[model samples]
Target: MSDIQIRPVTENDHAAWLPLWQAYLTFYKTELSDAVIASTWARFLDRSEPTNAALAWQDGKAVGMVHFIYHRSNWSIANACYLQDLLVAPEQRGTGVGRLLIEHVYKTAKANGCDKVHWLTHETNATAIQLYERIAERPGYIQFRKMI
Candidate 1:
């Protein structure tokens, strides 16, 4: 963990970031069109976009990634950060990479004047839920959504 370095993604990091992104989608059992993937990567590189991404590197390799977005919220005057994606390489799980990535988001959000940082994990992800519970409060809000 001491050797792990987490930093914002750069244009040169696309090759390293793609596998982590693909692994994340595979973990969720989902797939996206190439266009959507391209657009997402573009947004991360665009400073004007609220979407942001960072990668955790170790031994000259990307071990994890996180994507977050800042958006307005009626509940608070300051913007809220939505941690949309987080993933650690299968081999790196339980090695503190996930927590490090999440902490990175918390720090970034606070620095950007965000009121809070929030995210959702599948209810079945017990391992992740254990970590999440230890670090953040469970708001007890059941998510309701429909794919339009």
Candidate 2:
């Protein structure tokens, strides 16, 4: 979408990013503490930190956001970037905002020399799945997670 743009999130955007962050949690029906939200925003804004991104407006409003971190990858000798969270305002869904956010992540990963950018969403998130399929190859391996 011509109206959308992706940029490194700055500290000045924390206030704008919060409601979108909360919405991302709400989309998954989860909750997070304000402190954690504050910390995450601070971490992303900190230039010293590695591998993070957010999508904002060409029109000057924060329409959507994505936050990812780089980490070791056993499959690749080079590091990989993992998308931790992505959110588009509910009103902005289906308007190409999600794909733009994803493309931004890929561009960021490429610029950083990452082997790949990867992430997962709930199986039931059909809308995102549809968009994901359009932009990237399907994952061959299934994911399993356990909280220790």
Candidate 3:
């Protein structure tokens, strides 16, 4: 794990970040338009945007990516951090890359005075759930959404 370095993405990191982003969408069995993808990448590079992204690199190759957002929460005075997406390469799944990326978010959020960090995962993703369970508590809140 010492060789794996997790850092926030810079403008130069898009070449390294794209494939991982695509892989994440594929893992979730979803797809986004090119315009939406472009907007997302741009948000990470925009200083005024509350969205942020980071990647885990090992042996000079990006092996994982995490995207999070800071937003106002009615229940808390400080903003809350929502970890929107987390993905580790298929071959690197159990090697702690996911945890490293998540911990990076935790530290970043704390430094920014966030009230808490939270995320959701598909119920069928047991492997990730195992890792998540060890590092964070399940708040037992069911998510209900109506897509516009």
Candidate 4:
């Protein structure tokens, strides 16, 4: 396993975050823009922004990224930490980068007084599901979405 350094995203990381964001979009086949990604990065770096914390680092010469947010809910005991985006460059996959990101998220959730950590992945992402199953309970609910 490589020594994965995990930390909160900084403004300067925008250039580094681009490829990972693109990979995440490609992984899901979504077409998003640089401007949108820029805005998202701004929101993440803003301390007052509700859900903008991102974790990122250079895996040697390559970059890996993770973004997450905490949300309050009526049905939950405490705030739920939702992992908004997580992506490891294809070259870095299967070498512990993903696991490090998830572990970092888990620790972040616990530190923030969150009762749980939640995220959804495509049903077809078998490798991710394997890791998630080991660390999280699959909620018996399907996600519904609408473009705003």
| Best-to-worst lDDT order | 1, 3, 2, 4
Candidate 3 lDDT for residue 84: 98
Off by over 4 Å in 1: none
Candidate 3 residue lDDT tens string, 1-148: 5599999999999999999999989988999999999999999999899999999999999999999999999998999999999999999989899999999999999999997999999999999999999999998999999999
TM-score of each: 0.98, 0.92, 0.97, 0.89
Candidate 1 least-lDDT 10 residues:
1-10
How many clashing pairs in candidate 4? 1
| Clash statistics: count for each candidate | 0, 0, 0, 1
Whose lDDT is higher: candidate 2's or candidate 3's? Answer: 3
Better of 1 and 3 by lDDT: 1
Name the top TM-score candidate.
Answer: 1
- Point out where model 4 deviates above 4 Å: 56-62
Give lDDT tens digits, candidate 1, residues 1-148: 5599999999999999999999999999999999999999999999999999999999999999999999999999999999999999988999999999999999999999997999999999999998999999999999999999
State the TM-score for model 2: 0.92
Candidate RMSDs in order: 0.7, 1.5, 0.9, 1.8
lDDT of 4: 0.79
